[model samples]
Target: MSPVLLFAVSLDRAHLQLLRQRYYYATWKADGTRYMMLITREGCYLIDRKFTFRRVQLRFPRRGVQQGCFESHHLTLLDGEMIIDTVPETGEQKRRYLVYDLMMVNHQPKIKLPFHERWKLIDKEIIEPRTYDIKTNKYYRYDMEPFRVRKKDFWMLSAVGKVLNDFIPKLSHQADGLIFQGWDDPYIPHTHDGLLKWKYAHMNSVDFLFEIGEGNRQTMYLIDKGRNRKLEGAHVTFPDDQDPSNLSGKVIECSWNPKEQCWEFMRVRTDKPTPNGWHTYMKVMRSIEDNITQDIVLDEIAEIIRLPMYAERIKLETQALQHAARRR
Candidate 1:
């Protein structure tokens, strides 16, 4: 079977009620390249969104073990994104991998486990050991690793204000949107409504297969999950400064320009092998049409999640979810 990666659907006005339906873990959607880390007996590797794997010289230390001792973890797969952060004062850049999910550990599939449990395992098994080694100076050559590894933090929906106003402003990295992950859901492959992404109006964009027709006419096509492409009849125009020959056959990120009444190129999507599927395209369009903002979503959350009528129900549901996770 060909390996596939999961994609997040856009969160529109219709999906705002999800705030009350299920407990979600929220994180700032970092503008980074998606990749999965696979640990094997041989070494460590990073698998990109296109399923291309590249080996990196790194070792995982055994938790609670002596310094300089490393373990050959087998078939451990973790999902994350690689981000480049700039030092505000010095203008220096730092490349780091922020891990957000654990798929499999030591050949044991954790996809069946709820997100909360999976995160606990990630902390205890994957992160803590390496942290111990690094802190105790037992692990040398850490500087030789390709990038720094850190765990991505998630917050409750109520604390989203802090995420937007506090956490994001302090980070040296750029964040284009926000992510809402299902706290009780399993690791779902491919696209799932359980995972939601919200972005500002102008920041909303789609990845499409760019094409150049006769007479220098530019066109865009939508690519499906199976890597199938379909003509979408979108008028794409490139600036004179950008060579059409260079972008004709690659995936391009584009957004709708209401005033100009055409699709505008944002950038070339080198990280994405194919374009967004039909469902994703329609949802993105709807989000653009509705022009939803952070404040609107927050207002809806206050109505549905914090209303006096729903307080008891929300409490009960939270307790049940916790109990079920503990049983697992």
Candidate 2:
């Protein structure tokens, strides 16, 4: 069976109020291909959004007395994205899988657990053990592994500046926006309102299926599974190095240019099988017109936090964290 995936909704004015209602952990949204890693006795595999699985030539240590140095006896499922990063010292590019959430660990389902608890389990069980092995040279065939596994870091909403100014600059891969995940949210399979993705107004983009017409003219279509709706004002010109014919039937991202009054080609979305639907396209366009800045979002959050009504909620959240920490 395939693991159901959760999708993040676009951040808007309505989402701003959610910050006051509950605590959220924020991280940079990586511009990479999303995948679910399943570790079983048979083998370790990467499952894509399209429900395609690719077995990896790797193994996980049994961690305890077994110490079998093989894939775990219990099934483990993880959510993450695959990214290509540049190694600073060697200036060489390498593929890395950045895991963000845990679904099942040791065959025990964690989908019902709070996001904070699930993340903690992923760190203690999956990330730490592997890291310790690598550092101590325990020899789990590290040299034979195709890619490195990493835990994506999350921070409090107050640390948004640190993420944008400090963490992003140090990253070797591309990050498009900020992701806000509810601290107490359970793992909802699809379109979780508590999970939000926010990009800079100018950085907002939409994916469309590109088609070439007569006279080398081009048109863009939104592939919404049920229908291929043509998008107006989506005129595009490919880069000099890219061939239009080669890009036919491919999904391409485009950002609206206010001054130019047209959509500008951002890049080809090779990872996505289809373009976004009508709802997503309109939301992105509205976000662009609203032009909400990071400063504005921060200000809204600060204002909400100062209210007396949210005081008790903040206190309870703090206490919950403190209690969880003590238990750990």
Candidate 3:
């Protein structure tokens, strides 16, 4: 089955009061490879971030092996994080899946259901029973979704404090930031409300269509989707190893450096073409203003996250549409 993809709002605390509207939330770390797991009675399918898919056929238990388990019912189309680990002892790499969401099950769509409701279904139907795969002689089970936190408990600075101070340090996976999912809202494809992501100040980056200037010039302009050339301050300054001149027309990530008062290079984004919208750029700027560092305190982090933002994005978007319409 084809999967419906959804995009989350890059988290800015500015519009956080939207959370006050009777919402439940969960925090998940963004890391490793992303894939959508599609399960059917016939077999299981793996879909990557690009929507490329490969099906894995279901096989019955071997002749001599006891009847193991049937996980077709428990498994569903899910958003997942895949981590490849190299065994320190065996010098072999193993793939692991961390299921983040349940979008469908039993030939039915669950994305329309409330976040909490869908989670309940997943926990009771799948997690309690433990879904497994019988590949050759090995038993494989995917990881559970991230922990769900009650809004009230999560709102307290102490809870967030521990995650930043203790929990995050213990994780071996690569996490650019924490994802805040809305419990009461339905999963909508593409960009919508109910999903929020938070990351470190330095992790705040924007993708842009850039070009190398004439010879010996170390600077380049980052162009928006609208072909709006971001000149002057819009020119990104990458690391020494990255030849800015050789990166013509490539999409790269750039973050604001508050200390340097300029946009600095983060990395190159290969997953998709085109850059984030103006709203995302604004959010990055706001994050830079917070001056958050790796050793930030919990309260300070909370204040930075709770601050309202992107409030004008909707209006700006509408205006952009109208402008385009006028041109038409």
lDDT of 3 by residue, 155-179 (tens): 2222466666676676554567666
lDDT of 1: 0.81
* Candidate 1 lDDT by residue in tens digits, 180-216: 8888898889887878999876778888888786998
The Cα error of candidate 1 at residue 166, in Å, is 1.9
Error of 2 at 61 (Å): 2.6
How well does candidate 3 match the true structure in TM-score terms?
Answer: 0.67
Q: Write down the worst ten-residue block by lDDT for model 3.
A: 145-154
Ranking by TM-score: 1, 2, 3
State candidate 1's TM-score.
0.89
What is the C-alpha lDDT profile of model 2 across 243-272, one tens digit per residue? 887778899888777887787778888767
Q: What's each prediction's TM-score?
A: 0.89, 0.87, 0.67
Error of 1 at 72 (Å): 3.3
Between candidates 1 and 3, which one is better according to lDDT?
1
